[model samples]
Target: MQIRRVLAATSAAVIAATGLVACSSDSSDSASGDSESSEQDGPIRVGTTDAAKKAWAVLEEQAEAAGLDIEIENFADYSTPNQALEQGQLDTNNFQHLKFLAEYNVGNDSDLTPIVATEIIPLALFWKDHDSLDGIEGESIAIPNDPSNQGRAINVLVQADLITLKEEGLVTPTPADIDTEASKVQITPVDAAQTPSAYGEGTPAIINNSFLDRAGIDPNLAVFQDDPNSPEAEPYINAFVVRAEDADNETIKKLAELWHSPEVQAAVDEDAKGTSVQVERTQEELQEILDRLEEAERNS
Candidate 1:
């Protein structure tokens, strides 16, 4: 997303299973050249918060299958998309978690909703061969300093048994939550996107799939990541978000239908090469996940 503004301190935590406004994969570049020009009235304009262009290759196929053409637009930041959409700049947009979308609507007065889910890409924990999370004592454990995603990244560590929290911390957890005086490893929070590259200092770094993918490191290299079956999987999973009024819109439905098709799921596995896997959930299931995430954020 070539954001005119870098949005704000994510009003939410960094990496609970549900992804926030920022996505590191699909570089912040223009959507593929495959798009038809924007002037045509038959093509619908779809805006995205991240590098949706890459995944949008599939979207293009979906549109073709549905007998509609589209002009894909990309945005880097999570904030203000509703304003862009409601203002009629885009026919639809697919970015930000439903929670972020809900918060955006509450904060900005719009009625956006999800037509369906696409895929949930998990944020992974990468480290040099430290053997196991158990033996890496008295070492540096790098997380993010960003208020939105830091704690979510750390929770990955806790889930992997690398560290324990005195209690679950806020949207972003500070080092103090680690019982720093007694913890085996020294905890340090780096910038969210910088953690993957921060591995050279002999500390294990936690990063999201987008950052890790952008860094070109193999996902298999990561010592730990969220399990697909784990309770923490919801936040990391993503969806095709839209306006509430378009909940029944054919274009949006066709786009989601294409994504949920078995063919697309197989493509996600092949395209991601096993690094980032996709998930299937019903509309009701997506709603439940959103409710659970809100509950977790409230609890955190």
Candidate 2:
């Protein structure tokens, strides 16, 4: 991906206006639902946060060649796609990780499930005010405010030795969980969408890869990056999401197959440039994580 791709990632105002709707929970089979029957006539609608049309162009061509109809709709942020999927506006979505979807379900009382695993885009701490971690001492640092990724930002800071978290095994630590006395820098929380803009405010902000990519920042320059293969990163693997009812839908299963195909994986790797690591997990493991996250979210 190039500068233009970054521009596309951030260019959601035009699409958001038209694509985002008040996501309802009523998924009926009246052409709007994920009914296997509804997939017989037209292209299956898929949702993503960024415009992945180019990223999946090769896959799209291949799907077309195989007589499979699919269309990807890009949204502005994380919240809308699951809502749209639950409400039957989209056949499936591939924008979020299982933990994110689980959190969404817990928050909304919806049960959108992940049927296929995609890739893990590791979270990294990028700084504009400092060239090295040592220079970040005593500075006010910004991190993502969303519950799902907030703990991740904190974990990166912990890995960087900037702060210490009070809890032993917090899956989603908030600012309240920070051990201020032991911390070297002041921690501030802001919306995940605002993390990119949090920089240059006399503070180094910890930005996620999705937003960092949108800002066109070089991933290699990140002062610290989380290991995507670590146990902590298991919840962050992206996936194809669908309503619980469509878990067995043949078209959706086929779409997942196409997405995980070697050709498509190669295209994703070529375009992602080291930003995303392709991954696949057993369905049982994915479900177990989902169940655990659901329990955690409910408890939280």
Residue-by-residue lDDT tens digits, candidate 2, 1-300: 111111223234654477644222333542344445425335567777766535667767667766776666666766667766776667788888878888888888887878888899888887874557877789888888887888888888887788888986787888888899999998788987787887645558888777776777676777778888888888898888877877767777677778777788777776666677888886668888898989988988
Candidate 1: deviation at residue 233, Å? 1.9
* Per-residue alpha-carbon lDDT of candidate 1 for residues 12-43, written as tens digits (9 for 90 to 100): 23322344322222211212212233322334
Residue 213 lDDT in candidate 1? 58
Cα lDDT of all candidates, in order?
Answer: 0.59, 0.74
lDDT computed for candidate 2: 0.74
Q: Which stretches of candidate 1 lie over 4 Å from their true place?
A: 1-42, 49-54, 80-83, 98-111, 129-131, 168-176, 200-202, 291-300
